[model samples]
Target: MTHPLTSLSGKKGLIVGIANRHSIAYGCARVLKAQGAELAVTYLNAKAEPFVRPLADELDASLVLPLDVEKPGELETVFDAIREQWGRLDFVVHSIAYCPLEDLHGRVVDCSLEGFQQAMRVSCYSLIEMARLAEPLMKDGGTLVAMSYYGAEKVVENYNIMGPVKAALESTVRYLAHELGSQGIRVHAVSPGPLKTRAASGIAHFDALIDAAIERAPQNRLVDIDEVGATCAFLVSDAARALTGDTLYVDAGFHIMG
Candidate 1:
């Protein structure tokens, strides 16, 4: 028999921020679908729809829509579609983050005000917005998982402005979990070790970071997208009902090093 905790049958979820096959959001979507969860997947814009559409079809997503958090009404439009089609939601995977090249490649101290604000809005505040919109739909309770990184806690050599942005995201997860627990809603941040996703490509010296993680991590290897997906699959499953307000690490034990 399929374990009740691992099976996501009848559950409905929304995944935001799939830029390509290598995206963290795509990884999460793949596992969730494999676990039998119905999904609603979003693409960033017209430019991204072509790339994401094929993946959505492969997942058999019930709803495929555009969701650019910065664009007015786009977020609400997605939630509205979910409400109309499914009437409820069980989980949401938020895997979006952005910082302009100039800001991301430079020192945090040199980041422009606009760049800092934009990064925080996209990477951190968007989670808050998602939680708010998802709350009403998760009537029986649900889980909210956001992608985070080890750099959110420690200063990595080339992780620059996104470090503080993700720090804020982790804090948001804790606060949201506390506030929503009464409603049976849980929130968490999944921090994966260095990945080779398109988003990670934006970071300067990311290849070096990945190599260092493989060498220093206790597991003596790097975690892959599917591994991260499996961790997220667990997070959004009934087996993880007791876990919330925490940052779960899927980083091959790299976060423990000095």
Candidate 2:
């Protein structure tokens, strides 16, 4: 028998921002599917499709669509398909974030206006758009989970412009939770310890960040995608239904250090 708190059987979910097998989105998809939830996964574009499609297949995703959040119609298209195919949504895992290389490697003060705008749009605003599109589909009320990082709370070297952007993302989670709470919708940010991911690779000196995490974390180790996924799986389940608008760290106690 499945435990009601952990089992996701019969629930339908949409996962955005899967770039490859190593993506956090993929990890969440893996666990969610394992717990019996049906999923709809998206790739960024044709270039990403080849990599993401196979993983989606492995998860037995009911819908594998292209979703370039920056593209005008693409985001809407994915939700449209979900409504047409499943008529409702149970949860959404948003794991996409970006910043132009120039802005990312430079000091936050040196960040160009264009770069700042682009980072906010892709990394922060996209979640708001996803929540808007997801609201109607989450008829029975659902969850929205966004990936965040420890840098959002405290400055981390080389994290640069993304730090402020993620701070905004965290704030968005709180506001969304408040606005959507009355309808039974829950929102959360999952901040994981440093790990080698395609997105993290864009940060300059990312290795230093990983090393620092391992040295300072209470567990004295970095958390893997699977560990992050387990935390997200709980947030997406009914066991965490009462929790919302909070940042849950899966960083092995690293966030608690002075």
Candidate 3:
């Protein structure tokens, strides 16, 4: 069976925040490459090299650079590296997010100011940072996608500061889409149901949370990382040209439940 994504034979992509094969970003990278999109990836530090190196080699990525969201100059360095290697980019996937573990396992109202600031900075502000740097490289226009979750729209216990971070991310998508539309660039969010990523495991009771999601969602199962990846590939592809400034839920219909 043929995949429903647009042909990406000559396009290039930059995907940030891939830590391992189980990561949603890695899923996106895999599908995008399978569909003919040339890829570039980013790791948070040298420690991640052992994990990301094989995947980068597997995809025949144009480049793989270090990019810690909190690290000064990392984003600029990666963008410069991409520019040097590819000159132009056709798509970028912002798969990065963070929050203090203490804040995530407790009440939202109890979250510390520092925790909130850090969460927003890493999860929400990073997209803006990427957009500013990538816009120039997308001379012919391109797609920008950010990862989101159901917690941003509904109350999910143990999701705390990260929920608001996703809310800000979703809102930023609209603002960016509006600003970048004239240049023919698209911006959107892909919200997936709960899944156990290395980051997700940090949240207290994450296993029970996944069980609850599988029980309540229409599919009666947690969404696979690859499913999220495939959706991302479609969103960034040409077939999804009519879509922008929207949050497309790939959450097994969990977001729609009461």
Q: Against the true structure, what is each candidate's TM-score?
A: 0.99, 0.99, 0.96
State the lDDT at 120 in candidate 2: 96
**Poorly placed runs, candidate 1 (over 4 Å):** none
Worst 10 residues of 2 by lDDT: 17-26
Instruction: List the global CA lDDT of all models.
Output: 0.94, 0.93, 0.89
For candidate 1, what is the lDDT? 0.94
Task: Tell me the deviation in Å of residue 225 in model 1.
Answer: 0.9
User: Where is model 2 more than 4 Å wrong at Cα?
Assistant: none
Q: What clash pairs does model 1 have?
A: none
Candidate 2 on 48-80: residue-level lDDT in tens?
Answer: 899999999999999999988889999999999
lDDT of 3 by residue, 136-209 (tens): 99999999999998888887887877888899999999999999999889999999888789989988888889
Q: Residue 247 CA error for candidate 3 (Å)?
A: 0.6
Residues forming the 10-long window of minimal summed lDDT in candidate 1: 1-10
User: Clashes in each model (backbone N, CA, C under 3 Å)?
Assistant: 0, 0, 0
Of 1 and 3, the candidate ranking higher by lDDT: 1
Evaluate residue 105 in candidate 3 and report its C-alpha lDDT on the 0 to 100 scale.
Answer: 72
lDDT of 1 by residue, 44-119 (tens): 9999999999999999999999999999999999999999999999999999999999999998889999999999
